[model samples]
Target: MRYEETAQLENPRSSVSTDMMVGTALYTLAIGVFFVVFGLRKRQRWIVFWGATMVVAGAAYVVAIALGVDK
Candidate 1:
């Protein structure tokens, strides 16, 4: 294909939506909470660490989205 066609095909904005981003953030938070609870019950330090990390990242993502920082 031509370079122009390739460039046109790479429209990043069309690849995702704001709602999708929010949904992903929410899903990540849910998974983090699940892991955290399970880790606490099972007394697993690594799982708890990972869960906390993910929870913080997810919270940051959601906050950024809310603040329009992602745009």
Candidate 2:
């Protein structure tokens, strides 16, 4: 592709709607919650750690979207 054309390429994130982003983030949060719960029940520390990370990331994403900082 030409340099100009590449430079003009659209950002995939720019095309995503707020609703879709929120939905995805919410889904991530749900998965995280599930992992945390399941890990606790299974006595698995790693699973809980990953789940907490996911929860933090999802929450951050939601906050970023709300604050209009995603752009």
Candidate 3:
């Protein structure tokens, strides 16, 4: 029987890009707005909470990007 070893690959380059970060922020904001609209239309408290959470998360992402923490 032969034993084989697997090597792990790592990316030394930074994974963050200005365009990608901005796009993600915009996407998250859109999703938050959608959730808010859905919650209002459905009159669901849980949906509203989720929507608020999404907004906060999106804001945090934006801040992280601005701070260059993605690197």
lDDT (CA) per prediction: 0.87, 0.90, 0.84
TM-score of 3: 0.61
lDDT of 1 by residue, 1-71 (tens): 65554444464556788898789888999999999999999999899999998899889999998898966
Task: Report the Cα lDDT for residue 11, model 2.
Answer: 46
- Candidate 2 structure lDDT: 0.90
Clashing pairs in 2: none
lDDT of 2 at 24: 90
Q: What would the TM-score be for candidate 1 when compared with the true structure? A: 0.77
Candidate 3 per-residue lDDT over residues 1-71, each given as its tens digit: 98798785786565887787788887887898889889999999888888888888888888888898978
Q: Is candidate 1 or candidate 2 better by lDDT?
A: 2
lDDT of 2 by residue, 8-68 (tens): 5474545777798799999999999999999999999999999998999999999988898
Model 1 per-residue lDDT at 20? 88
- Runs in model 2 deviating more than 4 A are 1-15
Off by over 4 Å in 3: 1-11, 67-71
Model 1 score (lDDT): 0.87
Report the candidate with higher lDDT, 1 versus 3.
1
> Ranking by TM-score, best first?
1, 2, 3
